[model samples]
Every structure is written in C-alpha cells, then in structure tokens.
Target: MTDNRTDPPFVADEGPMLHSWLDWQRETLAVKCARLSQDQLRLRSAEPSTMSLLGLVRHMTDVERYWFRNVLTGENTPGIYWTDRHPDGEFDLVDTASAEEAFARWQAEIANARELSSGLPLDLVGKGLRGGEEVSLRWILIHMTNEYARHNGHADLIRERIDGATGE
Candidate 1:
C-alpha cells in the first residue's frame, strides 16, 4: 500500500492514504509533551506509576528504538529500561541527566526510527522473538501508534493537572 499520510486518517479524507497511523501518533505524542519544563515534564500522576511526561518521552524513545530500530531494522541496541533495576528509570532522573542529554537521545532515536519506518512496505512481515510469532509492518505501525495514543492521553491529563494545559 502506498503511504499518503500527509494528514490524519480520519473523516474519510482521501488525500494521504495513511498507510501507517502510528506515524501520526508519534509526532502527536511529541507535540503533547512539548514546551513542558523539566520538572513539569517529569511530574507524575500517581505514586504507583511513575508515568511522567518526560517518562513518556523516555518510554517513547524506547518504543521507537524497540520497534523501528530493533524490531523493524533489527538493531542490536539494548533497551534503556531494565527488568529489575530502577523501574522508574524512565521518570526519576538525577539532576546530572541534563535536558540536552535526554532530548538528544530521543532525537537521535527518532531520526533512526523515522528512517526505519519510512522504507518498509505496509504488508511487510517478520518473526517476533516470542513463540515463533509473525507480525506485519502494518501491525507494528498500528501498535506503536496505539501505544503513543494511550500514553499521550495520559500525558495530557498529567500536564493539565500540573499547569491546566490541555489539547489534542
């Protein structure tokens, strides 16, 4: 399928085919998190979940890397998150981790992610690491978008609570 996602894939607009909705979601998440201060970006919505705005950025960094860099492009890079160590590593950061570092990481990952996402057929297929599974390029794209769509909404609410800022 041809990618025509110049606009969103809604209202039956026939301009861009929107072969990958996740593309929209990725940028949407970034837009939602944009302009937030370091502290405000790192603010949490709950004691149990450290899903801060910055955390979402970090997590999305991992997501982009996981799907685009690792799964799609088959990169051997390790995840920034760990299984047992610092579960909230995505959120809780020392002052030593400057905004430039985090932003740089995300930006670098995003550039690679966009490259990976750009050069694939929508029906492309690959085997997942678990259970001899198979996944299509379409599925991967949609799943990434779904991940961002959900978390971005969370970020919206959290940011609103932080400073009454709200929008799609």
Candidate 2:
C-alpha cells in the first residue's frame, strides 16, 4: 500500500500539533488498508483473535462517535456497532460486513468529530465524565492519537501478514 501520510509540522502550537499527529495517524491506517480486497481486510490475525483491518476501521468509527459526539458534545447517542448483547461485534462479525459501508461510516465519524470539535478550545472540559472525573478536550485529543497509534501498529502487522506489505 502507498503511504501517503505527510509529515506533521516540526513547529506548531499545541492544538494544531496534536490535530496534525492525529490526522497523520488516521491517514496511516487508511494507507495500511489501501488496495486490499475485502477478504484480505477481513482476514483475522490468528486463531482466537478477532483483529482485522476492517474491524479496526469499524472499531475506530465507534470510538470516534463515542468520544466526540456522545461524550464531548453531550449527545445522547448509542454506539455505532457494539451493544450489550453484541459486544465485540465490530471485530467478530465480519464475514458479511461491507468494507465500503464500514469505510463510509468511519469517514463520516471523522468528519462529524472534526465539526463537533472545531470551535472548542483544548482546555474546555467535556460534557461527559470518565471514571466520575471530568475530561478535557485536550485529553481526548491526546488519547485519540494514542489510540490510533496503538491500533495502527496492529494494523501494520495485520497488513503485512495479509500481503507482505510493510512501511510507515
């Protein structure tokens, strides 16, 4: 896959720098999934593990919606894929899942997250609480970057296993 991720800026204010790194991580995941067939994407990493590129996309979509829309913006929305009865559905149910739909949902979540966060400052506290503690927009941003970074590492191994493709 072609890694189209551009380097984040060397010098920038805190907010822009964080967003830049997050964006780069997002693009890196896309690059990892690029040019792959649905079967390739849905291929599990190994027995007893449900990790897959398509599953990661779906999981991230839910993560974005949970944090940005539900938590940060105080929207009372349910999760995109998982539920009490079908937890881990994003990763477990992939035999018939549509990659196109998954990607579309992921992209939409990203756009909505960007729009919902546009005017908020880093210091602004989120409307939702984590572990009974208030969370800041800055923390969410950093947490999300870390989330993507860790998942992208898994994506790297899965992609390489799928087609022997490897890179940044």
Candidate 3:
C-alpha cells in the first residue's frame, strides 16, 4: 500500500503534537488495509479470534463515534457494528461485511471527531462521561492515540499474513 501517513511532529505544542500522533496512528491502520481485496480484508487473525483489517476499521468507526459524539459532545449515538446482544459484532460479523461501507463510515466519523474537538481546550472536560468519570479533551486524545496504536499493531500482523506486506 502507498503510505500516506504524516509523520508526527517532533517539536510542537501539546495540542498539535497529540493530534499529529493520533492522526498518524489512524493513517497507519488505513495503510495496512490499503489495496486489499474484500476477502483479504476480512481474513481472520487466528482460530477463535475474529480480528481482521476490516474489523479494525469497523471497530475504530465505533470508537471515534463513541468518544467524539457520544462522550465528547454528549450525543446519544449507537454502535454501527455492535450491540448489547452482540458485543463483538464488529469483528465477529465481518464474514459478509462491506469494506467500502465500513471505510466510508470510519472516515466520516473521523471527520466528525475532528470538527467536534477542533479548537477545544485540552483541559476542557467533555459533556459526557466515560465510566461515570469526567474526561478531558487531552485525555481523550491520548486514549485515542493509544487505542489506534494498539489496533494498528494487530492490523500489521493481519496484513502481513494476508500478503506478506509489512512496514511502519
């Protein structure tokens, strides 16, 4: 895949630095999934594990919506790939999922997240609560960076297994 990730800045203010890293992590996952076939995107990582490139995309879509819309702005939105009855639906129900649709939703959520958080102070607490505790914009940015980094690691392995492709 042609990598389009913007390297995180080495010297910058806290907000830009955090956002750059988060954006970098986001692009990392996209790079891993790029140029793959539908079946290839849904290839499972291993037995008993439903993790796949497409699953990661679906999962991140929900993650962005949860943090930015539901938690950040107090919007009561529901999961796109999961529910109480199927907690792992994002990964488990990917056998026939549409890669195109998943990517579109994921990108849209990312755009919405950017708009919601733009120019908001890092120390400003969100309107919603996570685990019944107030969370700051700074914390959300850090948490999201960590979340994407962890998942991109999985994407790395899955992509390699699918086509022997590997990179940062």
Candidate 4:
C-alpha cells in the first residue's frame, strides 16, 4: 500500500472502466521512463544484468500480448518475448534499443490488447492452460490487472534506482 488510504475496487458498471485501471498500471510503469534521457533509460539496473526500464517496457508489452490474446483467448500467435534461441531475451533488451523505440512498441502492444479485449463479454468463457481448465472473462481481466500491478511495482523500483523518481 502506498498510502494509508486504500481506495475501493472499481464498480462493475462498465468494462472499459475496469480495463482503464489495467491500462493505468501500464501507463504508470511507463511514467518512470517518460522523462529520462536515452542513456539513462538504457543503463542497466546492475552490471551484467540487462534489466533496464527499456527492457521492462518491452517485457510488459510482450506480457500484454501473452496474457490477453495468446493464453487467455488462445490466439496461439507467436509471442514477442518467447523465442528458442533466447528464452530470456526480454530481460536483456538493454543498450542498442532506444527509449523512443521502446515506448513505440509498448504503445502498439497496449493498442493490440485494447482491441482484443474490447469485444469480450463479462462472463465469456476462455480455456486456460492450467490443466486445460476453463476460466471466466472477468477472471482473466483481474489476472491481467494483477500481472500489471506486480510488474509496475518492479518498474517503480527500477525507476527509483534510475534517477530517484518514484510513484505508481
């Protein structure tokens, strides 16, 4: 909890409102990267570790695709981050990738997610990969939201280390 005041959960009035929250987390993750210099954004969080904010942005972009359309909806589209040669390449996108390119990719990923999730009904059924089980559309929304929340925290930490900036 960032503060003693905890807000109530989003009302179930509309789907867009709830999804906006999910988008908010991703936007907040980008917030930490917004004002940094390209050099700063490219700098690794630690030596020999390529976990820069840029990398996180790309990873989250891949994550948005993985969860929304691929896994939950079973699109089976090739994943951006999962490749045979470098399974963990998502974490190693440090230098040689500019902040502008990273932001552009993130924006595109979020756009794709928004489009994919737009038509899903609240109670829509999706077959999950866990033992080939089925899950609710609402559940996937919450799961995606939670996934964004967790990674956003990591983004916050990485941002603070980058230049002492913090929040959301």
Find the candidate with the highest lDDT and give its number. Answer: 3
Candidate whose TM-score is highest: 3
Assess candidate 3 and give its TM-score to the true structure: 0.98
**Where does candidate 1 stray beyond 4 Å?**
1-6, 9-20, 94-96, 127-131
Candidate order by TM-score, decreasing, is 3, 2, 4, 1
The sequence of per-residue lDDT tens digits that candidate 1 reaches over residues 1-168 is 122234565564222234335556666666666776777777778888767777777877777777766666556677774334775566665233455566778878878766765656777774344245666767676777778889878977887888787776
Assess the local accuracy of residue 81 in candidate 3 as a C-alpha lDDT between 0 and 100: 100
Q: Which candidate, 1 or 3, has the higher lDDT?
A: 3
- What would the TM-scores of all predictions be? 0.79, 0.97, 0.98, 0.81
Encode model 4's per-residue lDDT on 1-168: one tens digit a residue. Answer: 132223335775657667767766766676677777888776677676677777778788788777777666787766675477877677764557666876887788788878877878868776445357677767777877788788777777777887777774
Ranking by lDDT: 3, 2, 4, 1
Q: RMSD in Å for candidate 1, one decimal?
A: 5.2
For lDDT, candidate 2 versus 4, the one ahead is 2
